[model samples]
Target chain A: MTATDRQATGATWLRRNRQVVAPVLFLLPGLLFFLVYVLLPVAQSVQISFFRWDGLGEPDYVGLANYRELAGDRAFEVSVINNVKWLLLYLLAIPGGLFIALFLNQTVTGIRLYKSLFFFPFVISQVVVGLVFTWFYDPTFGLLNAILGAVGLGPVNVLGDPALATYGIIVAGLWPQVAYCMILYLTGLNAVDPEQVEAARLDGAKGWRMLWYVILPQLRPATFIAFVVTIIGALRSFDLISVMTNGGPFGSTRVLSFYMFEKALGEYGFRMGYGAAIAVVLFLIMLVFIAYFLWSMWRQERGA
Target chain B: MKTAWTTTAALALLAALPATAQDESLSGTLTIFSDMSNPAPRAVMEDMAARFDEMHPDLEVELTIIEREAYKTQIRNFLTANPPDVANWYAANRMRPYIEAGLFEDVSDLWAEPEIAENLASTKSALTVDDKQWGVPYTYYQWGVFYRADIYEEHGLEEPADWEGLKSNCQTLLDAGTKCFAIGTKFLWTAGGWFDYINMRTNGYDFHMQLTNGQVPWTDERVRTTFANWRELIDMGAFIDNHQSYSWQEALPFMVNGDAAAYLMGNFAVAPMREAGLTDDQLGFYQFPLIDPDLPMAEDAPTDTFHIPSGAENKEAARAFLRFVVSPENQTLINGGDALGQLPVNAASEVDEDKFLEEGFEMLSANAPGGIAQFFDRDAPAEMASVAMEGFQEFMVFPDNLDDILGRLEQARQRIY
Candidate 1:
């Protein structure tokens, strides 16, 4: 065919399939990235879990050995338990954020300043937050001990004690997470329908009754996002544990992510396959929540 | 004037001939990856590179100094994917993984040379695995009980001679409201130091080596005896409270402020203690007390080394660089008081006149007839060291948890080895 005929046919095809082609063309980069960076890595990690590799030499097939080892691994047990503590305590940030958002939502002078002040922790780096909390909980001369001393209580070494170290790190993690959730709630609060609130007020809905029945229902999207982010944040907690205690005081503060890093990339760790195993376990745990989140979103979209 | 110019030019040519002849074939870029990121060490590294570059005028020396902690993980990546001509690493089992993987070049021929054979003999075993030397030691520092001499004098304690004497001295310090040792196990490796010394002293260097080598079980009777010895100190509250929260540097304040009487640490602690205003009169060094006097004393003196990667393109230049690094002259210069402030690896190298270096040198050379260990973490496999150190930390915090900790370590030992 002539060049003009070929061009004319290509133009006609483009016009015919623009609807499907345009979206795919736009999504090509993102879809490629998602496949290469995320999906491929996840699959690779799962595959690696079945091998015995030190990241230096050839990988030997180990089958279920790594998983079997994890079953009896005390450090792995501690990390799983700490992760549970983190998950439960980390959810507290949602409510804490709601309360802070409520407290700061009022129309008052310098409200912007107050909101920013409350948002300050989220703006700061996680490492800084971890370091700040670490010093705050220092046994020797930390602000925590000084306050305890003032209140006639004995000095408590929070990070040093195995029982308390994980909780201490979770609390540090909560500081910024609560701020993040608060920002989401604050934005959600802004979009709340004032007309419905007025109708509720006319119907005698106020205070706790208005909040639970009227305001909270409007904040559903905010709460959902908060829950999703908080859950992911709790599972992926590494920087706080790393900076504050380094999964120390006998590996009490290790979450699966940090433990995975310790096994794969830490100074003493080159157990790539074992680390991949830990990563696989974490991925499976996350998958349950991810599936739930997706299903919920799908249902919500359909209902809308 | 003409005669004088010719004579001077001839003298310069004669002086340059020896160096240029030796390095005549070295022409390509020699890439070096060093973990000497600290300011002084970085300067020393840069100077050494410059000097090596000057010696071989045609060769280009490319030195990359990575942060020390980051280097630990980065070494694995670079050694495999993009290997350098030479790299810095610790000796002993720290090099074992790389050696076993055939990444590090076997430098046994360097050790066979008369100069290296005689002068660097002390550290030869540290660089050896499977009867082959893989690297050359650059510097090492002694580990001992750094203490407050003034406090010891006040308490009439004269550097304990035996385990009983050590315990008595500790008791004396404890009675005086001072913790006997200031240690931070937050990083976990500090606890390894204690385990090394106590195990080395309680059993012997050979037994300690066996335990670290994974030949002996973690739950072995000898291992328990070592922990039993360590438990005595823990039970006595010899260590500082909440040490698990502090780093090795943070624990320094306890010793500096006289809250703790002593610290069982490497010679590097001397610099910080001195910086913290502990004068020579206040600070003192003593070999770890004799636990089994019948057995000779072994000391933990971790040696830092340089190795040629097996995949290096310019190994001839790398080999020459390694020789220059360990040569008595360069060892002396690099490990001088103002430089690394550590003990020179070459025996022929003159030690700096610093008091701690002198004492450490004397102790390591003459007194430690048993053996010289490369610290607990260095001597043991990385995974095993990490697991055992964590156990050590747990033991320090809760002496009652020894049985559980040992069981966990035993499991790790089996899995790792």
Candidate 2:
């Protein structure tokens, strides 16, 4: 407010250019926090990957020894295969969510309640979801086995059987994931341009055709978000697997993230270097996808 | 000099302080990190800590109890960064890495000075690494086959003495529509218990130790014989149906309901079985049946310890706490409950009136002349133990894969050791 105070402050250009200066000042704290927490840890994890550390002492430089060990590990193989299965099967959520969203999109009585009810699993903690699904899949006294028994079929130990455990967990994970995607699609549908739809309808775009061309194109943002989250959910599948199976019934249900955690922190003795190597592998996997996504987005922006 | 004058002034100020404050009676805030998070054990620990506080009224103890799984990971980090004065840990190889890294302090003086070492000689060997004790092993429990006494009585099954006795008992139990054993390999460690017992009984204590310590290869003949005995149990349908589907805790229903005859587990299991409505007379403790008959028996006894972290600020207070913990009066609190029980390592500790505890004591002394094991996981390196536990679980589910499992174990053993 005073000329003297204004004179004492440096950078007259910044004072004049208030718009740029204010935005940079506002962004500084968030950017600093992001760099410290997320970016720093990621870089540190990458650095740790080269050394054979036990999480407690001086890390020994092992170069590619850990990655080499991972190459031959059966547990690693099983987990990688399981992760692939999770990725492929997890995509079903996008379609499943859209279907449920469209079904409940109508103005029926108690529609809001129905929508909320369908989204219930997503609202519940993952730990609770895992426990519920575990009891549901219990061989002796579970709902699934009870149903199987009712149908004159033998009781199948879904979580116990190595061949079936991963599938059982993925199905449990999908329950809430579908709900997430459904909510995204519902919100996207609410934002759909009514006039564009009217024009499409007048042009005889109806049913599957209308949804495929007119409606889905409008829900692109939602679909992109759903895909991103579903992929993340698949890759970092830890809590559900931890609660339901604990990578057990002979370590069949472990994913890359859970395996990394086990090697790094679990009582398998601290193998921090090996765990870091696994994390680096997983990061590289996600990086490839992210880089492609960013490239594609950049292309889209340029075209637009 | 100005520095000398400042030093003189500071010294004069210190000299003017109260004499009582400088007394070595340990009257400061003592921080303790404990992993006794289970309701019963945690209660026993709290009771012991409260007793310590009462005994030394001036010393205020701040006890922080961490959950078991999280504690294992956090303890290492805490020991490095900000350490509690006293911390609970496991003995043997579990403490070896910490001791070697100098994370845990060598409290050999406490063992020597107070003559507490003589009282707990049985546990001294376990807490000792490099001929020096790093911890005070306060508690451990016996592991064996817990059977339903009534079921055994009805079946005319005398306590199984050898492979034949065990086989006949299993046959009779199966004939009577009762499963021979209730094993839950879902957690995988339960199978390790079975492997330890059979390996020790078949090859004797020395061979079992050598094998677990990775001196003997998994492809060795003694291991094959051990697995052969294990295979016999598998072939006879010894374990309850779908044993793989349940955790050790979940498998208790079979024993409690009399659907299964016995469970090979630690003494901690008695608590759950009692909670599940089994009476004292109904529950019976017995060492696992002998396999070689010539070889001596060894029981699985996992010891829990308390140690002083090297970075402790209150070394004196931590030692004082350990002194209290090692007392026979405090050890008895671990056995106060009707069901939940852990045997105190202190030889002078009052014996429990509980029949199962008495039986455990008697069995441990009489049968385990060859020596006692610290269970499979505790006995072997954690890395190797994990692999072995997994392999054993797999073998339990698929008995025909013994050779493959053994080969895989050998590969892992070679990689680790």
Candidate 3:
């Protein structure tokens, strides 16, 4: 609050600005690209939901009609319910990944290679993942059936059965998601504050409580990132659904995004307006979590 | 340093110039986009491209094959920016939308070139929209019941001639502990084939025309009766369980193994089954068992056609390509592929005596009935086809709800225009 502090702060700002301004100019291209590609399309997609048009034709204003249809659409309702199931179940990957990461975090021979090998599923394309799982779930020639036969159980049509089809796809989706979370946790574990762990060990703190009190708190940022990515992955799920079942068995496995695509461009119809309406609902559901995350980040920034 | 640099530069320029010069010719580049990735189709297309280059000696043809399921979205995107000069497209309803958009070139002039128009008569109907032909016909296939001759022989049965015969045959097959029919409705289009044939047989030609044109109500008793017939087969436990997960190709093994008696599929299925080791003598072809013998028979076959895009850089070359495709020599090569199982669209184009195609030719050629029932999905717009096919699947599974399903289709019909 003093005149000397103000003068010193002013001097500091001027000196920093002289150095920072050039870097800011250098940063402009990437920032502009991010705004254009990411931010602008999102805004436009929200705006487009109010109108009706096939991609080729002129769009007509149809306030709330698309939304009204979406609300009444039994398929959309089913899809939204499936998406909720995906979001809830997808979080299991974090703990599963954390355990795998911790198990492999030690400095053993070829451990670095082991960690990379563990992350292989994450590196493979989702299409390939979907194909692999589809084969695994194939009622006749799949690994699941072969194993079940050995156990004297009958063959179960996993993907063909409407009730089990979504779960089958979800299991396939989880394979890569778990690998992704493992990588995040491995990186987080590398930065875990070994000095505090050693200090706590000297005080006879060894197991879950010691880890919870000291090591876990330090892994918050990594856990937060993992949680956010997993949630987003669940919400944005489409490729596996498209590849595996294609929302078959009487459209049992349709998630919201795929349902939106079906509404718009699928053989079903080019109900682009209705698709946009479904998309807007998905976006709003996502917005609640995004807003909470943003608010949390903003509070942290303010506190810092 | 300057002398050494100049010598190296001269050598590099000399090395590159011939290749660059060779690249700058019309005969040097040929690009294709297609959605036929079945191994046979892919091999056939590539071989044709290589052969074309060999004949031209200058133009290099590059072929790109995409999976069928992804073709529509990929084609839509490609057309938005740089449409490929040539691509595979369906004959009727699918082509009509793109043609209306001026996305396809009117190859009517090419059609007039005597060699083509006279050759591909059956397919020309599918390719032409509003009196202008948009594409050249490559292949047209007949849809019917492909049965196991051996199985029928073992069970003391013959190819069904009418509804009663079909029902009796089903009972005979079921009593033998063999699945009566092997159907895979996973794509939903397979069921459309069943619907198209059944409706064609049940209501005859005029009724089908009226139903497809959206002039007649789907809930009309004629259509309901078709559902009733389909439900009888379903209730008898004749179809394979989990039929929804199996593609037509995947279901062939069941028929070949005697797990099923017959497959209601297009003629194209024969090649794959033959490749899988079934012989000409083992397979039997039949008209879909007639729902009503007195109601005249109509062929429910589909044609595959090719159209040039509107903005093709080489217009004359594109026309020449169309003319070449429809040429008698080329149509014969196309039919000769054998794996294609299609009758050449042109009358003069000879059948290869490839057993299955011969059978298709005989069955398809007979009867002074109406025009071909262009595969249901192709005859109907894509949106309506998907809805109706799904409705058909539901009706097959839940026959009592025919009224509700048809009523729903009536609502969907209202939205098309």
lDDT of predicted model 3: 0.79
Could you give candidate 1's per-residue lDDT for residues B1-417 as a string of tens digits?
999867655654554586534523466899999999999899999999998887765679999999999999899999999999999999999999899899999999999999899999999999999999999999999999999999999999999889999999999999999999999888999999999999998899999999889999989998999999999999999999999998999999999999999999999899989999999999999999898879999999999999999999999999999989998889999999999999999999999999999999999999999999998898899998888898899899899998999988888888778
Interface RMSD of each: 0.7, 1.2, 2.4
Candidate 3 lDDT by residue in tens digits, B1-417: 999867655654554464322222234465778777887777767776665555444456777899987887777667657776677888878777778767888888887776666666667777878999888867788888888899899888988878889989899888879998888776788889888888888888678867877778777888888888888888998887777777777777788888998998887787777888888788888877667778778888778777788866665555555665666666777767554547777778788877668777877777526668787888887777877887776665566777878887887777664
Model 1 stretches astray by more than 4 angstroms: A1-3, B1-25
Candidate 3 regions with alpha-carbon error over 4 angstroms: A1-20, A60-63, A102-118, A149-154, A190-215, A265-273, B1-71, B77-87, B105-120, B312-320, B338-341, B394-407
What is the Å distance of residue A284 in model 3 from its true position? 2.6
Off by over 4 Å in 2: A1-11, A199-205, B1-24, B338-340
Model 3 chain B scores worst on lDDT over the 10 consecutive residues at B18-27
Would you list the clashing residue pairs of candidate 2?
Answer: none
Q: Given the true complex, what DockQ would model 2 score?
A: 0.65
lDDT of 2 by residue, B193-265 (tens): 9988888888888988888888999999879988998989899898987777788888888888899999988
Error of 1 at B169 (Å): 1.2
Cα deviation in Å at residue A215, candidate 1?
0.7
Could you give the CAPRI-style class of model 3? acceptable
DockQ score, prediction 1: 0.92
Candidate that beats the other on lDDT, 2 or 3, i.e. the better one = 2
Candidate 1 local Cα displacement, residue A272, angstroms: 0.7
